[model samples]
Target: MISATELPSTRPYLIRALYDWCSENGFTPYVAVKVDASVQVPREYVQGGEIVLNVSMDATSSLKLGNDFIEFKARFGGKPRDIMVPIQRVMAIYARENGQGMAFPVNDDEVSSTPLTAVQPEPVQSLPEDDPTPTSPSPSRPALKRIK
Candidate 1:
């Protein structure tokens, strides 16, 4: 029984909306509140580095439910725990740079509150004019043939 007023954040409405969505869809919405540095990088997470997430819930719903928050937990190679996230406690709800992050913005009905804009870092490009030397040398061969 979390209060909308007690939740210290400007984005309380957004979090509430997410919670409702999760409840309706048989899931739990846990945003990143804190990160653990001593965790190991699982074999599956080799491509993408592991990120510790502090999932918030009204109760120990995540552990009791089990199925919810699987995607986030597995991606970071960690087991879900009972955590409470105040609206103001959330620093970032990041998934990844590969078009896989979650952002919540203030909305009218809370439906449009989730941050749809994924901040994917642009791919790096190489310069074409890096090589100063030409592929083929000029036809001016010095002393090609010396017939004595």
Candidate 2:
């Protein structure tokens, strides 16, 4: 049995929340995923081992955002395709219009060390309180501003 302290990653829940937020605000939600053998996406559309998908209602059909994976039927090049993406493979989920979203870190070493089947889901935890104000801006990346 998994201990309570060994909680499941909040990535999936965050993704779902952001997706809902985008949809509610009439913004398009996009997910950036790292493609691997486990990901069922169009190889041709995947660029540099990564693919960004629009998870909006019109783009996807019968989209099931599960705890471990997101499964949906989408049209690619005018052909219907079933897409499956592991929550672990999801790097980021954001709105296309304002670039407001969250990014999850990817540890290449951990990916190589662990097997996908060994992964398990636990209960979700609450996020800690943090100031929304931006302190300093890094030159490499743009600063994130909270949207109303």
Candidate 3:
């Protein structure tokens, strides 16, 4: 018999499925990642430690959605860069056109601790005509501010 700890994470499988779904339906697949020392991406484009990536087949090259990590090469400002994000650090994966996708609860713990679930509401900036790879998503703040 296998224990819960022995099971692989459902996150990677779901991410691949969503990517396929978006591809089959002509929707752009975007992944929102919580940036840390482990995540490799452009710091200048990252807004408040979070970055939204356009993972569509048209945008990325040598894309590999693996079990432990998502590896790909994409262009930022027309300069190609290798992007890598640990599967557990992904905050959400959704269709950029319709905002229809799934979100995972990202934390320091392992992905197997909790089952995959629906996505979160993170607003993104409108895409530009020439550049649509790195979307500047405003960071989310759950706390309210005091105003006079």
TM-score of each: 0.28, 0.73, 0.73
The candidate 3 region of ten consecutive residues with least summed lDDT is 139-148
lDDT of candidate 2 at residue 77, scale 0 to 100: 97
Itemize residue pairs with steric clashes in candidate 3. Answer: 103-119
At residue 24, candidate 1 shows an lDDT of 56
Candidate 1 accuracy as lDDT = 0.34
Error of 1 at 86 (Å): 3.9
Per-residue lDDT tens digits for candidate 2, residues 11-37, read 778899999999999999988887888
Across 20-106, the per-residue lDDT of candidate 1 in tens digits comes to 556555554444432223222233422223233423343333332121112222323346433322233233343222222345331
Candidate 3: tens digits of C-alpha lDDT, residues 1-148? 9766667778899999999999999999999887888889999998877888999999999999998889999999999999998888888888888888887767644443244343446655677789869853445432221111
Total clashes for model 3: 1
Best by the TM-score measure: 3
Name the candidate that leads on lDDT.
Answer: 3
Model 3: residues with Cα > 4 Å off, grouped in runs: 108-148
Q: Give the residue spans of candidate 2 off by over 4 A.
A: 1-5, 111-148
